[model samples]
Every structure is written in structure tokens, then in C-alpha cells.
Target: MRIRRVGAYALLLDCGEDEPDVPGRVEAWRAELARRRDRGELDAIEIVPAAATVLLDGVPDPAATARSIAGWTPRPAPVRGTAGVVEVPVTYDGADLPAVAEHWGASVPAVVERLAGTEFRVAFCGFAPGFPYLTGLPAALALPRLPTPRARVPAGSVALAGPYAGIYPTASPGGWLLVGRTGLVLFDVAADPPARLTPGTRVRLAPA
Candidate 1:
């Protein structure tokens, strides 16, 4: 792992070139980092896990922290406790649903079947608060983003763009190809956790 100082408060840990087929490696690293932080070895306020990068936030000195953490290797850790599987129901009747099905030479039902068949993990939350960027989408269902972003994508919009699937937590502009919609509220300010999803949670999409 190569660590680099990105800014005053951020240290970027580059987990080498991304392994296209091994998403578990990234997830393992994330779990390890979270463990280290909880043990008080690292004073990170936020840990952002991406496909090939793990960003540590709220470091006193980015350069010093990067140098120190670079020497330490991470161990594989299993997700435990409340951070387990979360099933969500989806309605496969989006505006772009037919177009995506046509692109893959499959029916809408076929596309939905493939999506609901696999279990995806919450890789990270970004783009919008509580909006989990889920990994493990089937390769056949991996579609490109829209040519133009929508003016407003409603909350609970289940979309797939590139290799990631995500549900919009709130109404926002987005470019992802919408395949379905969910009735469940993903983000709620009134709630304790606010966001329904978190990193390390396994999510299964089901037909509503």
C-alpha cells in the first residue's frame, strides 16, 4: 500500500492497482482500517473505502500520517455485529428500464432477475448522504451512465452505472441508468443513524 497526503485533513491509501475481479480484498481492508481506528491506533474521523483506495480523514498531519500508515499492512477481517445483510425491495419499472434491457438483448424481467439474483455489499457511501455505492453487480447487467444527467432523480431510485449499483437517498441530479425504484427511505434525518445503509452491510435487491 502506498500512502500519499492529499490535503490538510486527508491521507489517501492507495491499495495498489485495482483487481477487477476481487472486490473482497478492498472490503477486507476497509474492515481492518475500521478496527484499527476503533482500537485508537488511528484517529481517523471518517474512513472512505473505494474500489482500490481507502481514504482516511481528519488527520493532524497528512504527510506524517501517510508515512506512518504506509508501513503497516492490513489483515483480513470479517464483518460482524449489526453490520450484516440488509434486504431492500425494488420496483423494476423505471423510465430507462426498457432501454437497458434492450441494450443487453434481454427482457425487463430477465434484467431484474439478474439484479435480484446476486447479493451486493455496501462498498461506500458518497454522491449523497446515505447513498450507498454497492458492489458485486453482475457483469451482464453492467451498463453505462446516461448521456445527459437527469434534472432530478427521486429518492429510492435504484440505478446501475458502470460496475456499481446505488439507491438515491434523496432527490438529486444523477447520470446513472435507472432500472427500478424502492419505497424504503434510505436516508432520514430524524433517525438515529440517518442513513439506512452503511459500509460492510450486504444488500439483496428483491422485487417489490
Candidate 2:
């Protein structure tokens, strides 16, 4: 793992190239950092994890933190406690269902079975407000982004692209292959946290 010092107050741990297939490792790192801070081993710092990176912001000393992270080995999947998993109800009736099934070489029902059966984790939140870039889709099922971006995708659209499954929190243009949708309010400006899917949260796509 390579640590890139972000200015003077943060360190970005690039776990991308080293562990391309295992994003849960990033979650492990985040959990460890939070554990350190909570136990008074680390100073006040924010542990923000992405697809394959964790950004430690508000670092008291970058070098010290880097050395500390470097000294530890990363753990495997099953990111955290069971309480973190959020069940998401999807309709499994996206317009792209046939296409996705064709790509997977499976029947429509079989595709739905595969999706609903997987346990997913929120690796990061990006692309839009409350939009979660979830991991857990196997590499063999990875698909490329749409050749032409859509002008607008409705809120609660559950989609997939390139080893990631995502939920569109609000209406906006996107390119991911839409396979289903949910009714849950994934984002609301008036909400306490605003975003329903924070990084490190677990997810399951349940057929609604």
C-alpha cells in the first residue's frame, strides 16, 4: 500500500493496485483507523474509505500516521458487525434487464436470483448525493459503463457497472446498467445525515 500525503493534514492510502479485487480490505483499514481513534491510539482524524482507498483527514502528523498504517496488515471481508447491513427492496424490472441477462448468459429470473443473493458493501459514496458505489459483485460479472450517458436517471434506480452496484439517490444522468429500482428514500436534504448509505454500510438487494 502506498500512502500519498494530501497536503499537510491528510494521508490517502491507495489500496487500489495492490488489492484490486478485494474492496472489503479498504473497509478493514477504515475500521482499524476508527478503532485506533476511539481507543486514543490515534488523534482526531476522519477515515473516509472509497472503492480502494481510504483518506485520513485532519491528521496531526502525516508521517506518523503513514508509518502507523504501514506497520499494520489489512484484514479480509465481512467488513463489520451484522447491524450495518441495510436491506434494499428492488422491483427488478429495469429496462436493461434483458441486456444484463444476455451479458451474464443467464435467464431473467436467474439474474434476479444472483442479484438478490449477494451481500454487498458500500465502498464509497460518489457520482451524486447519496449515490453509493457498492462492492461485492464478482469480477467475472463486471460490465462496462454505457457508451452514451443518459440525460437523467430517476431516484432509487439500482444499477451496476464495472464490478460495482449502485443506487441512484436522486434524479440525474448516469451510465450504469440499470437493472432494478427501490422505493426507499436514499437521500433527503432535511434528514439528519442526509445520506442513507454512508461508506462502510452493508447492503442487500431484496426483490420487491
Candidate 3:
């Protein structure tokens, strides 16, 4: 890991080339930073994670904080349980489910099974609020976004693009292939954190 300043109050941790397991590494760093923040070791406002880097915001001393994190070894995150897990109940009936199954040479039930069986980790949050880019879809199941994005994808619409699976927190234009729908409210302004699927959270899709 390498740290560089992103201005005066922000620092970015570059974790080298992106890999299948990079999100886990980023989560480890984010958790450690949160611990330090709680202990008064660092003054940070936000710790945002992405595919290959962790952004530290509101840092009082970027250089010193960077040096401290560099010397610290990241610990392994919890592999199971509900510490950071979000269980989303899904209805596996989607407009593109048939097409997706055809693309994978699998039956409809097989597609749902494959998606529900995998464990995903939120790699980042972008494109829309509360919309997490989850990583963990098997390579055999990975596919590209639609050539023509829909003018507005419905809220709670579960979609997949590239190697990521995401839910539409609110109705908006999107290109990801719709695979399912859920009833969970992904974003609630009244909630403490707003976004239900924060970066580093483990996500599971359950048939409802």
C-alpha cells in the first residue's frame, strides 16, 4: 500500500493493481482507521473506500497519518456473521432474467441460485447514493452493461454489470442488466448513515 496527499485534508491509499480480493484489503484498512478515529489517534471525518484505494478525509496531518498507516499492518476482517452484513430479500423475476440465463447457458433457476449462493462485499459507493458496487460475482457469471441504458431504473431493482452487482437505491437512469428486485429501502435520509449498503459491508441476496 502507498499513501499520497490528495490536497490538504485528504489522503489516498493506493493498493496497487485491482484484484478480486482488493475490496477485502480496503475494508481492513477502513476498519482500522475507524478504530483509530474512535481512540483519538486520528481526526478524520470520512473514510471512503473504492476498488483500489481508500480515501481519508478531514485529516489533520496527512503526512504523519500516512506514515502511521504505512507502518501498521492490516488485520483480517470478519469472514462471516452479521457484523457488516446486509441481507436483501429478492424476487428473482426480472425483465432480463431470461436473456441473462441464455447468455450463461443456464436455466432461470440456475441463475438465481448462482447469485444467491455467492457472498459479496461492497467495493465502493458511486453512480448513486446508497448504490454499492459489490464484488464477488463468479467470473462465469460476469457480464457487461446494456448497450442502451434505460431512461429510469426502478428503485430496489437489482442489477449486474461487469463483476459488480448493485441495487438501484432510487429510480434513475442505469445501464446495468436487471436481474431481480427487492423491497428493502436502500437509502433513507432519516437513517443515521443513510446508505444501507456502505462500503465494506458484506451482502447476501436471499430469495424472498
Candidate 4:
């Protein structure tokens, strides 16, 4: 892990070296930082995780804090139990369902079964509000983004790209391969937290 200064008051952790296990690393770092903060060893307002980096914002002494955690080894992300996993019921019929199945050299039922069997966790939120970039898909199953992004991917469209699975929270342009959809309301403007799928939220897709 390498720490780079971000402007005057923040630091960014470049986790490029741990690309394959970035999400787990992010989870581990966040937990460690929070633990340190609780013990009065660190101070930061936010511990945000992205595709490959974790941003430490509102830190009083960025350099010192960075140095403190520089030598610290990252632990594996904790596994959440079934009771804590959010189940999103999905209708396994999408425009790109056949394409995704073909890419895996598997039948539609096989693909659906595989996805339903795995657990996912929100790695970050980007592209749109409440749109979660989930991590769980193995490296062997990684796929490229759509060459021609859809003009407006409908809300709740369960999609995948690279090693992540995602859901379109709102109707918007997107490039991820659609494999299914859910009726779950991902976003609500008036809600306390607004987005249902925040970073670290565990999820499971169930066939409707």
C-alpha cells in the first residue's frame, strides 16, 4: 500500500498493487482506521472506498496518520452472516442475459444458478445515486464493459462488468451487461440515508 497526499487535508491510499483483492483490502483498512479512531490514535471524518483506493478526508495530520498505518498489514474483510445479507429478489430476464450466458459458455439456468449462489458486497457507490459497485464475482469470470453503452438503462437493472455486479438505481446511460432485474427501491430522495446500498452493505440476488 502506498499513501499519496491529496491536496492539503486528505490522503489517498493507492492500492493498485492489491488490485485483485481491493474490496477486501478496503474493508480491512476501514475497520482498522475506525478502530484506531475509537482508541484516539487517528482522526478522520470519512473513510471512503472506491474501485481501487480509499480516501481519508478531514484528517488533521495527513502525513502522520499515513505513516502510522503505512506499516500496518491489511486483514481480510470479515464475512457477513446470512442474517445480515440483504436479499434482493430478481426476475432473471434481461436484454443481455443470453449474451452473458454465452460469454460464460453456460446455459441461462446455469448462469442464474451461479449468481444466486454467491454473496456480494457493495464496494462503492458511483455512476449514479444508490448504484452499488459490488464485489464478489471471481477474477475468472470478469468481463469487459459494453462496447456500446445503452442510452438509458432502466432502474433496478442488475448488471455486471469486470469483476463487479451492479444495479442501475435510476434510468440512465450505462455500459454494464444486464443479466436480471429487481423491484427493490434502491433510492429514495426523502429517506434518512437516501441510498439503500451503501459501501459495505452485503447483498444476495434471489430469483423472483
Candidate 5:
């Protein structure tokens, strides 16, 4: 854990060498931070988890906060033995599907089959609220972001970038290559848990 001062806010960054043991580390930090915040030991205004780091905003003192976190050991990783695995139905008719297939030296059907064969876990939510960063995309399908970002990608648009896959939680500009679309609502403000794809939750994509 490292702490830095940014203007009026103190940012605490946890590499979580072990806490976020796997791809879903961000969610572990989220739940842990919530517990600390509830105890009033720390005041955390915002919790942002990315591919590699968890940013905690609004620590009164950076030096003291860093000392506290560094001295304390993180708890065990969350157990998902009882967590539900969410399966989403997708139509493999995306504009970039064929291009991606060609890039991988495989047919479109082959690409789809590979994608559906494995299960992925939600690693974190970023880029947009409720937008999940999923892990476990096969190495063969790993691809780069588009050279040109689309002005707007609709909600539930399934996209691939590098070794990760994601579903757009809301309409937003994105550069990931679209592979399919799902009818499932990933983010809904009115729902108890706005983002359906929480960390630790498993996701299996299937043909519509």
C-alpha cells in the first residue's frame, strides 16, 4: 500500500499483492473498505478500482493513512463458493466479430465457440459505473482496442479489449471491439445492486 497527497485529497493505493489474489481483487477491496468506513476508523469518500490499482479518495492525512494500511495485513480473499454465476445470452452478430475472427486466424463460429467455452469473473467496475472488467478471455482472442473509438456504444454491448471482456453498462463512447450484444441490464439505478456483474460473480456468455 502506498499513499500520496493530491491537493486536498489523500489517495491510498493498494497493490494488494495477495488481497486481490486474482482478477477480482477490486471487489475485495471494495467490501473491505466498506467495513473500515463503517467502523469510522477511516473516512473514504470514493473507491475506484482499476485493472491493477485501487484508489481510495479523501483520507485526512496521507502519511498517517499509509502507515496504518501498510502496517496492517489484509484479510483473506472473499470466498465465492456460494456466489451466483450470471449467464448472459448474446447475439454473435457484432460488426467487428468477423474482423476479430480473421485476426485470430479462425472462423467467426470458432471464435464464438472459444468465448462460450470458458467462464469469466468480474474483476472491477470502471470506465462507467456498473461497467464490469471481466477476466479469463482466452489468449487466442486477445486483441487491441479499436484505432477509432465509437461515439456511442449502447448498453449491454459486449466488447473485447486485450485479455479482458466487458459489457457496456450504459451508452457511452468506447473503443473496444464489439463482439456481441446482450439483453441483460448490467446497470440499473433503481435496482438494489445497480451493477449486476459484481466482483466475485461468474459470467458465462452463450449464443442467443
Candidate 6:
């Protein structure tokens, strides 16, 4: 890992390189930082994670925080206690469903089976609030984003691009292929946590 200063209040830990399992490593660190922040080990205001980096925001001492993070080793998936795994019910009836099956040389049912069978983890939130970029999709299911992104993708759209599977928390523009739709509300600002799928949360896709 490489640590670098981001302006005055943040330290960015770059996990470096793209391995098939980089998302898992990033999730582990993101959880660890949360633990530290809660215990007063870190006085940062925000711990934001991405595919390959964790940004520690509002830190009092960037250098010291970087040193601490450097010495730390990644642990197994964090204990979320009662918040555990979230099951998302999806209706596999997307516009790209048939195309995706053709790309994979599999039938539509096979594609749905593969999607429902694999488990995914929330690596980070980006693009939009409460929109999580989930990792752990089987590599065989990975595909490139649409060449021409739709002007607007409806909320609750279950989409896939590369090795990530994500739910469209709110209606907006997106390029990920829509493979399904879910009824679960992924984002609600008035709710306790706002985001249903916070970082470190595990997810399962079930047929609705």
C-alpha cells in the first residue's frame, strides 16, 4: 500500500494495482478504518473507500494517520453484527438480459442463476448517494459498460459492468448494463443509516 497526502485533511491509501481480489482488500481496510474512527483511534470525519483506495478525511495529522495505516494489516470481512447480509429481490427482466446471455454463451435462465448464486460485497459508494459499487461478481459474468450510456436509468435498476453489480438508488444517467430490477429501497435519507447498503455490507440477489 502507498499513502499520500490529499490536500490538508485527508490521507489516501492506494492499495495499488488491479488484482481480481482488490475489491475485497479495499473493503477490509474500509471496515478497519471505521473501527478506528469509532474508537477515537482516528479523529477523521469521514472514511471513504473506493476500488483501490481509502480516503481519510478531516484528519488532524495526515502523516501520523498514514503511518498508522501503513503498519496495519488487512483483516477478514468486518463484523457487521445484526446489520449482516442484505437480500435483494430482483426481477430478471432487463433490456440487456438477452444480450448479456448471448455474450456469455448462456441462456437467460443460466445468467439469472449465476447472478443469484454469487454473493457480492459493498466496496464503496460513488456516482450517486447510497449507490454502492458491489464486488465479488463471477468473472465470467463481467462485461463492459454500454458504449452509449442511457440518458436516464430508472431507480431500482440492477446493473452490471466489469466485475461490479450495482443498484440504481435513484433515477439518473448510467452506462452499466441493466440485467434486472429490484423493489428494495436502497437509499432513504430519513432512515437511520440513509444507505441500505453501507460499506462492508454483504449482499445476495434473489429472484423476485
The estimated TM-scores of all candidates read 0.84, 0.92, 0.92, 0.92, 0.75, 0.92
Runs off by more than 4 Å, candidate 3: 18-20, 82-84
Per-residue CA lDDT of model 3 for 38-70, tens digit only, reads 998878899988878899999998888888887
lDDT of 4 by residue, 1-208 (tens): 7799998899998777556677787767766776777888888988888877888899998888888888777666665569889999999998888888888889999999989998988888988888899888888888888998989988999999988899999899999999999989999999978999988788999988
| lDDT of every predicted structure (CA atoms) | 0.83, 0.86, 0.87, 0.86, 0.77, 0.87
Candidate 1 on 121-195: residue-level lDDT in tens? 898888889999898866665788999999999989999898899999899999999989999999889998898
Candidate 1 deviant stretches above 4 angstroms: 17-23, 60-68, 77-83
| RMSD versus native structure for model 1 | 2.8
Residue pairs that clash (backbone atoms under 3 angstroms), model 5: none
Residue 114, candidate 4: Cα error in Å is: 0.7
TM-score of 5: 0.75
Q: Candidate 3 or 5, higher lDDT?
A: 3
Q: Which stretches of candidate 6 lie over 4 Å from their true place?
A: 78-83
Clashing pairs in 4: none
Off by over 4 Å in 5: 7-9, 14-45, 60-62, 73-82, 138-140
* Model 4 misplaced regions, further than 4 Å: 17-20, 38-40
How far residue 126's Cα lies from its native spot in candidate 3, in Å, is: 1.2
Please give, for residues 6-37, the per-residue lDDT of candidate 6 as tens digits. 99889888887566467777777888888877
lDDT of 6: 0.87
lDDT of 2 by residue, 27-135 (tens): 8888777777888887745788887788989988888878887887755544366576799999999988888999999999998999999988888888888999988
